[model samples]
Target chain A: MSDSVPAASQSNRGDDFDRRDAAWYVDRLVHLLVFLGGVSAILFILGIFVFITREGLGYLTASFSPSEFFGSIEWRPTSDTKPTYGILALLTGTAAVSGLAMVVAIPFSLGAAIFIGELSEGKTREILKVLVEMLAAIPSVVWGFIGLSIMNPFIIDAFDVPVGLNVLNAGLILGLMAAPIMTTIAEDALKAVPDHYREAAEAMGATRWQVIFRVVLPTAKNGLVAAVLLGVGRAFGETMAVLMASGHSVNMPTSPFDSVRALTATIAAELGETAHGSEHYRVLFTIGIFLFLITFCINLIADLIVRGIRKK
Target chain B: MTMKIAIETHDLSFWYGDFQALFDVNLSIKHGRITSLIGPSGCGKSTLLRSINRINERIGNARSTGQILIHGHDILAPEVELLQVRKEVGMVFQRPNPLPLSIRDNVLFGYRLHHGKRGLKSSERDRIVEKALSKVLLWDSVKDRLDHTATQLSLEEQQKLCIARLLPVQPEVLLMDEPCSALDPSATEAVEELVWDLRDQFTIVLVTHNMAQARRASDECIFMLLGKVIEHSETGEMFVNPSCQETADYIEGRYG
Candidate 1:
């Protein structure tokens, strides 16, 4: 019986069995490629952070004053006599516009998300999702143009304000811009909740509305909050649209009709005019750093909230 | 004593988008007894169990032509309210799925749904929670941690809590689709014992893949194959003197 055993099997043992074939080499190559692809994202983010800090470091250390930067509204970067670098007006501008944008966007985005994720079915859900994504795909520049041409005239005509471009115009435009992405993220959050939770709740005789309000909402609350925070981040970082529709004036916006300059708008409007390595240029970069930090902190909080849900 | 019918299905046929699962399934389950539905996989046992409470409709394109009577009322009728049907017939899934809430809230969820949250004193809610937990024999281990999340419990405890949450609504028929399948042997034995204890209070329709569990835990046994009922008899009679060749073949471990 031992002699009858195949000679090919005996010959192929040990060294031959351990041989790496073409497929093995290909698999290793693909693994290395994927690993590099994953690492590149982190590398690019770090590179951007380093570049921004290097450009802004001079202003942060030497000429930066806590009271002038945060406590006053004077932001005359090109003044021949003692340029003022205060950003209080710009900070309030961003805050007022983004806060108002959130007030306008939250209801529309969350309602659309619930409809898409929980209520609609089959083709209707698919079509609505595609439409919302298409809304997000519209260029930010085009949104700024609309704020300039359409909402500019409409706000003046309707609200009877002096200038068409102000916090109201910028806020309405930014809210519309932010709603689509918020809807998408909120919908994903609602979808991430297991279908088993819905099944269990429905089996317990919960009405459709009751299941959404009581069970699904509570379970997905963290993700929903993260979605809203991401929307806030987007509103804060937006520059071109806010610049166009906010009338590009530096002031503490006391009402929706008052024109104001956002932090991002200040950097965008001044960086090109300033000579390289000058205090003006560095101050613009300093504003860039501040914007970066605010967005980073918002995103970190959103991530932690999402991670809290995963731990449970 | 005359047997009271808790559930009766007349010529029930179901389809999942033209692929029929249950074909002309007729059954009469007695009240206040445990009836175990035993069959191999893909024999439509779970389908039948889910159909009792009309939960099968949750799957889009699932349709049925049947008359399901519970306590002499045709629950399949268009006029029948789904919430009312679900309140009368509760279900437990193969895997335990506790809501992401406190154990106390999970126990009170159904009660609050049926009886509005308002007008209920804290003492009354606590009493309801304690009684339901005690019925499932879980109060002793978890009495002190009532505010803890229900999803944090062990598998056996979660399954017990799943069953306990159904009691506050006072469901007459409890449908269990392989409740112990996710548990280890010892947990299975404990859950089986709990089911046996519940037979005196609720009419339980248990769908199990484990033949030994059907023999040990149920009063009546049903053997099904290819969506057809092969045998329905007392547990002892079915094991010893099965009337159908298929039932004998199945019980004797000849073939599934």
Candidate 2:
């Protein structure tokens, strides 16, 4: 009996060690797969940065005048004899459209978020949430088409503008496009705030509106800032809707009613026609670089602010 | 011969959708005394407490068909403003739920909610904050950092601040739902002492699962079972004298 017991015990130890070895190998394999996944994502972003910079730098090196490119108000890249690559006009057009979009988007989106997060209940809340998400799923081209058909005529008739397609038309569409993301993020932030704060405020005899404004909004302040920054990033980067709605005029726009061409629209419009590896084509990449940097900075600041809020 | 009643509930029945959480609860709580509601989990002690200030209405589909009266006012009346009822009766939750704001701001929040923000000068706010903090016995520890966020304090301090914030509104009654459940034994004792001190000024109703805490801290004890009140008596009498069978079983650890 003693001999049989020792033999069984020895075999159990061997099986245990083999099981542990198998577990170790599986753990290592999972670790390797996760590491590769992370690295590949980073590499893709870095690769885009490198390729854009390499192509864009050729223009700067080949007698591109930084002063004229930045300071002047003309962007006639295909002017045959003297293709002035001044992007000031495009920059202003981009700024005007994005600024107007933000002005139009912030209030409406925040109100929607509050309604969804604080006021809606059960079936209504769920349906509203899903509807907001569906808004985000609509294609940019559809928005552009809608703006061209419906909004253009409305703006022309209502405001008596010379042309239906202008900064105002494009900005309103862009604002619509940006509103979904803003609503989603702001609503998430508002919901993330614990219910206890609301209860405490209510227990102190604060009205529902007062509780939302005083307790919930202040607690979600950083998140709201992040949401706005992210919305700005989305509006600034949007291309197709603005392209179709704006009249694509290469000039510095001074009013919401003026026809204008954004940097994104400029690139989308010109990149197809320009000869490959030419100075003009390279300048387009430079504009791409500028677009990239602006979006990157805004997103980075938003991410940092959100992280700080989460830590607190 | 006439005892003042702080809170009176008549035929109180509460439901969460089809599920009844509380049933026909009739309770008359005396003024200036601490009453502890003790029951097993799911016996609806917390629900009963939350119903007093209509906080239960926050849960979607949760309905109540009953009359709840605070100081002779029918809180469930259609014309009664919910804000006024909440102001008269304050509640502390199971967890420490100080707003993510400065310590001073947390104390002044209730006051500012009832009174407009611009009406109170900075000096007056400071005085109110100081007095409230001092009442909770947190003044000495947090006085140096009134501007600091309330969340940065220890859990005990946070719970105290939660209680302190309610005082500025001068609530006639305080409802605590397991206020010390999140604290250590020593902190629990300190909080119980604070509750005892505040009892003279406010009618305090506390819900606790800890029978020993209910016995040691409360002036009156209520035992509930399966969403029904088993007994309500003086703390000593409830513990020492014979009572309902379920109360005896629960106290003797025979069954929940």
Candidate 3:
């Protein structure tokens, strides 16, 4: 009986071993999951990059005349006579369009973000924020459609342009589409600033505009820069909006009125017609590789900028 | 040490929406003197300092009864531009808030706004910035890399930079809300010494919950409780002789 009592007590103690408090257990699980999941996702993403690079980078290394892909300037693969797939044209177009979009989007988005985050009143600020959020929820295809219908007429008539499907239209639409995401992220970053900063600036006899432009914006610059880089990435990867807005002729567009085809749109447009494993298909994949590299570089830059700001 | 009255709050009362934050608090801020507002937290010490410069207006539906006179001009008057009011009355906060710009930019931000590009030549601007830093005693440490980002400064230096930024504008009154609350002992000492130095050029309303800080820094004391001015006197008189039992009990540490 004494032996039984001791043995039962030991078994009961063992039963209580992993039975932690509910709140404590939940807290521990959440931390564990978050840490594990975050690392695993990063690893999985990195593995995808390695996979794509290994498969797709081979064509890039092929003779152009051994290295025609990166070194060539031409992009017409539909025509015969061993069509050249040099990505210089598509790349130039991407750079131009993305740059223009950023120029339009960054300022307006930053302004909207600041205005929405800093200035507007209780209900008005909330409403504006919600409205901007709704804009983000609108599908990319709907934005493309909207650009074709209303935007086409508005720009064609207002600017006296023959066709609205020019770089200007594409950039304008892209800016509009990108604004919501940009403004939301930027606003979140700006809102993250402590109230004490604004109070300090105001106390320093800084005007409202001064407080905003000088103190708030500068202080939150890392997040603000991240927001802008994110917007540029969106503009680069966007297919339908650019496809509908940018006139898709293979020839290089010199003016805003002239139709431009971004690399993304070109891939989407010609992929079906091109025979699989053909040089054109390989070129499209090669453009994909280019895109992957560019986005990767931008993400790296954004991270570096954030880290730099943090160190300061 | 003899100086004019830099600011006077006459029966100033502030309300956040329907909730009153301060009531009928009359006080005078002497130039080149630090007047500390001491009370328990949430006792309207910070609120009263903020209302002095009409900062409460930034809040939605904030209103005030009574007037704030910065050199006799009623800030509450409609004709007075708030921007100008802020310029005349500068503030320092508990936490050091330096802009995320180069040390030079953070110091001259106020100057640049008021002066614009035409106001000061780059060389002149540098001199002014240097002078302002020297006033706060941060020049020697930060002088080598004036163009480096402001965040690189230590906490004490950052708060000093905030002070330097205000020096450029040369505001008549300076309002400080717990300026040394977030600092270590040495940093707090640095701020305290600078406050004593700056009082010659500016009227200061220094707010703190620490009674010792009030005694150390202030010439006059305003004691607040439940959003009302419970007592106001010269620091010596208020500390040595008590008028109200409540004040006596509070000073005796009955309850915060």
Candidate 4:
């Protein structure tokens, strides 16, 4: 009814224009193209997951019976009439090695992270951070060579261990590789805790250690868990290092000094020799499926735990 | 009222890198009396309070050249133990901050730090923790759940817990910098009452921008402008007969 009415409507009109700006024919075409392009990429990648399962899962089932599969421990699958496909030994080996690696890695990494996050001087902190970050960027193959050439012998001598390429040797080497990544990520998480908590602690006459233990670590629990999960993911997928230094045996681990067979090593060793469509090849694929499931479930559980923490 | 110099600072100056935060703040504070420092933003009221507890020394890139004596101990001297100075002088910040600990642990943490688990068992620690909470008037509501995390308490209760957390060590001085800045009116009143109750045992120095609160709570008010202490006088006299034009200007809202 008045000029003010037009001014009031102008703000709404501006909002409408904003809502419609990206809806013109050209913009719509561009958006549609992007959506289609992303979907196409996903479908193409997903096809690999499907094709592998289709080609691989059938071989394991057709090659061996449930009884044979459950009971067999020998993994030296050679071309013969009576084939063995026992993976209990292999599965146990991988689980033991991975679990041991995590145990060795978590405490040292978390402590170093807290030191870097809380106590280090500015220049020293940056240098230490750079060193850890560089470790994370180093190739897995390089780590393997270093472990074989240097770390394995030290383990053999220091602990008076038997085999140079046993689970303990491999696990220790892998733990070293994972520690830098764990430290860097956990440090970042600890840093995410607000300055207020630190000040509050100090104001209450809390020593620096008390502040770190009671406040910084608890507040950054989500981030610390994320770091550990990420470290586990790296340890799971590692192949060259585990293959090279793990002594590559199908034997179940008795202690840190026993040789072991991780899933990745089994696949790597067998993939080149097996003929396509053979039972061995299918069984190999099934092992791949199982490995993928383990890693997937670990990550999914970690994500759920993180989400639960955030909701609180 | 008996007047005694509880704490004193001489030619006190502080800097954060090249920027001066406090400039030659020479003031004397009385024991067991509330002294309110009122000023506009960037006027260095907060800086003065932090220096009293020697907390400013820990801020990275911050330096001070001053002689602050807490109960006649040279706080700014190189030989003075920072921890001992801190143990005698406590602080409460603008925002309510409770450590991520059990409510009971928060109160007894000081004893655990300074004494290292000697001369007190868990039972005695709990009693002192309870007594500290009662001093701040929070024991009744929170007594049922001493084991609950301090973070779960309401904002005001957390602030009171912060105050209570400082009591067990029996600090001679309490420095509060804008303690009610993050609180509602009701919460602010509760804290004001606690401050008044605390004056019997602790020397209280508070910084506030709220003139009404400054008038209501403080016995002696020190007015400042542009990092200079304008007038340090009794609250009633300073408001009625301000000696400086800058103090009058700030009080009347003419120019900040």
Candidate 5:
């Protein structure tokens, strides 16, 4: 009986069990494919940083002046006598528009997040979440179109401004563009706070508003700060909408009604017109590097704050 | 002599989105005593505890049809204030859930909710914090670091803090739902001792899965099976001679 069993087991151990079959090779192939998919994100970011730095290196080595680039507002790059590439006006415009966008977006997004994450139940929450995601998916170009056609006319009619395409128009458009993503992230932060905390607070006779303001919001404060920072990053890097709405002028904007030009808008509008190896092209690449560094730092800070909370 | 009933329930039935959890549960828990509800998993003990303060209504589809009276007041009535019901009846969860605040603030959280911050002096707040923390036997350890976050404490201390936070409200009934299930053996013993100490001042309804815990810690024992009370007697009598066959089967090693 032992001999017969051994013979049967040997026969059963055919090529499928003894050797690597098709499944083994397919598994190895999938492993390699997934590894590449994970590593490609880091690779793309590094490649873009290197390429922009190389393109801007010529201007940085030869004619770049920190004071001239950051202090002066003159940006006449096509002058016959002398060309100046100072970006003070562009910096102020970007800062103003982003600052104003944050002011407009913070309350709306936080209120929406509180409603969706804390107040609403089943169907209302699901529907509002889907609508916010759809709003985030709307293209920046379409937002630009709205800013140019609808908001421009409304501002002109309402405030009696001579030119509607100014800081107020662009800031309002960018604020709307940033609100959906901010709302989604803030909702996620509020959701991350455990339900038991709410239960404990409610069991202690706290009203709904008291529970939210005292316990839930305090627990999710770090995540909320990260969400606001991410929204600021989004507002700072926006180009198409700001270009279409900001009137694209190189003026130091002293008021919301003054026309201005952002750094991103300047790069987008003038990159195609400048010669490939010219100083103007290199300066635009330098602006790209500045933007890359700012957004990268903001995201890094947000990530660190999130990781801090996780560690706690 | 008659025992005063702190919490009385009549014809209590509960459902969680069409799944019936409790059917016709009528119980009168006496004041200033530790009554334990012992059963297997999904026996509706926790549900019943949550229903005392009307906190079960927080679940979206949870519904109950019954009269739950706390000190002769119908808490389930429409005109009854929910905040008032909760203030009079405090609950402790199986898992320790201290608020994300300092130790002082956590102890003062319920007090601050009931009393606004406008007229509350800092010295008065400190005294309240000390009194609540001292009641749970946590003042000696955590008094030095009152400003530290409450979540940083050990699980045993966190559970103690959870109890302490409920004391400032001065609730008559303290409903504990497996308060020591998350603790280690030693922590469980400490929490059980604390619960026993507090029995003289507050009526405690403890839900426990451990039969040993029910046998040792409770004054009155309640045996439940399949959402119905099998027996309710003195802890010694219930353990010595359980009247119902189902109660005997559960108490013994036969089946849960």
Candidate 6:
């Protein structure tokens, strides 16, 4: 309570002065700038999502029900009269092609990843890794071109179909395009697992395959799921490859050999020809919303499954 | 009543890409006894333990020469399958590395690997789990949460679970490479108690830097310096009466 109190308060005042120095202000200013920089991309993405939703919401009026958008298969947005906007055909086409692509890709990519991560060594492993990365670097348009020029004819000859551009053809091409990415990601996941797990499993007398499937794969389950989700995402949103490979016939895909049209191709082909802010243009935005929602749901479901595995 | 030799390595030498790690390690480990390999850091105690089960060979460039005989079978023979060798000798690592799986699954991991999954009934597998967990004294704490992930357990419990997982396979020998090095003092003592309890059933070769643990836990002790065995004697004799100057220096804590 005596003179010591004033001395302590004087030191506190000096500390406050130090806290408000030029260096401190500059540090805070830099931090703010970095924080703003980090958030700008997220802000732009949110802006796009909100803008698309605002434009798309007009189509959900009395003239167009949500069921018409989701339930019907017809997609004739340009018909002067009786224009039907059913997206079921396109949706089925996307689903079928993407599903088939995953089925074709998962086994081969996972096996290749395991082989590279667990089996290969020295120059062989190095060469395989470089080749996989190079495969990933190939342009999507080139993959589309390859599918159209080479695979279409092969499929047309093999199945004796009049049209080579079908769900199977598109799916096989998508699978090939997605393989390098899936293998690279899965291999990274496998290699990231601590060596201790491998040693423990091998010590328990597990064969290499057993160790890979039982220990390594399960340990890296989250990353593996991420790899598959990213692969499926790439296939689902692909426009050029699916458009070039899949015959643009808006029909319900009854079989793998049936020609189909994906939602992305429809938008790409029609958006340029439609009048701005017209009903057809707004419907395209609605389709964009659908694409966004479906991809969002797939990611959410995959995340939940990965979380469940982690919890176990 | 001389015990049978459970494991024997004759002139065993190991190399990692031209850098020799183990040089002419010759020793016979007796059945149903605890033998501790004691040494300073990088003294090849852990290397010798791994070589017994061919775990050292997992490294990309690691190569070994000479014979390792287990139960009268030469494991280092060209015809001998590494799978068979590994199956016969189980190992535990320094860190508790339980698979990201349920506790029950971890216990049955080795069992299901050796025996096909369909061959064993639920009740049989349950019995094996209970037996193994009880052996390591981990049943009471984790008995309620068998479905919980093994990683959720404490370091002590996880280490115990790691030991329990090795039991279902009925391995002839168990190699522990500084298993308690990652544990606290209390957990180290607890694991040492479990290791002592496991004696006389499975042949145990433990690599440890702790002189106290070697003396208190192992029946026989092998002291190494720079990849060469300095002395192999009874624990009490090694501690009370060390023959080699290096062994005496290590025991006296003159320098590691």
For model 6 the local lDDT of residue B21 reads 84
* Candidate 2 CA-lDDT value: 0.91
Kindly give the stretch of ten consecutive residues in candidate 4 chain A with the minimal lDDT sum.
A14-23
Once superposed on the true structure, which residue ranges of model 2 sit more than 4 Å away at CA? Answer: A1-11, A20-31
Write the number of the candidate with greater DockQ, choosing between 2 and 6.
2
Say which prediction, candidate 1 or candidate 5, comes out ahead on DockQ. 5
Per-residue lDDT of B52-134 in model 6, one digit per residue for the tens?
A: 88888888889988888898888989898877787789888889989878999999998888887787988998999999999
Query: Which tens-of-lDDT digit does each residue in A57-101 have in candidate 6?
Result: 888664677678789987888788788899999999999999999
CAPRI verdict on model 2? medium
Clashes of 2: 0
Number of the predicted model whose lDDT against the real structure is largest: 1
Best by DockQ: 5
A45-153 per-residue lDDT for model 5 (tens digits)? 9999999999999999999999998998999889889999899999999999998999999998999999999999989999999999999999999999998999999
For residue B48, what is the lDDT in candidate 1? 92
Model 6: what TM-score?
0.90
lDDT of 3 by residue, B28-120 (tens): 778877898877778999898888878877787898888888888899988987768878888787788887679998888777777775757
Model 1: per-residue lDDT, tens digit, A135-199? 99998888899999999889889989879899998998899999999999999899989988889
Off by over 4 Å in 4: A1-49, A59-71, A79-81, A152-163, B117-120
lDDT of each: 0.93, 0.91, 0.82, 0.84, 0.92, 0.89
Please say which candidate is ahead in lDDT: 2 or 6: 2
Q: What are the chain B TM-scores of all models?
A: 0.98, 0.98, 0.95, 0.96, 0.98, 0.97
Pick by DockQ: 2 or 3, better one: 2
Listed for each candidate, the true contacts retained, as a fraction, are: 0.74, 0.82, 0.74, 0.62, 0.90, 0.82
Worst 10 residues of 5 chain A by lDDT: A6-15
Candidate 6 chain B weakest lDDT stretch, 10 residues: B80-89
Instruction: Tell me each candidate's TM-score.
Output: 0.96, 0.95, 0.85, 0.90, 0.96, 0.90
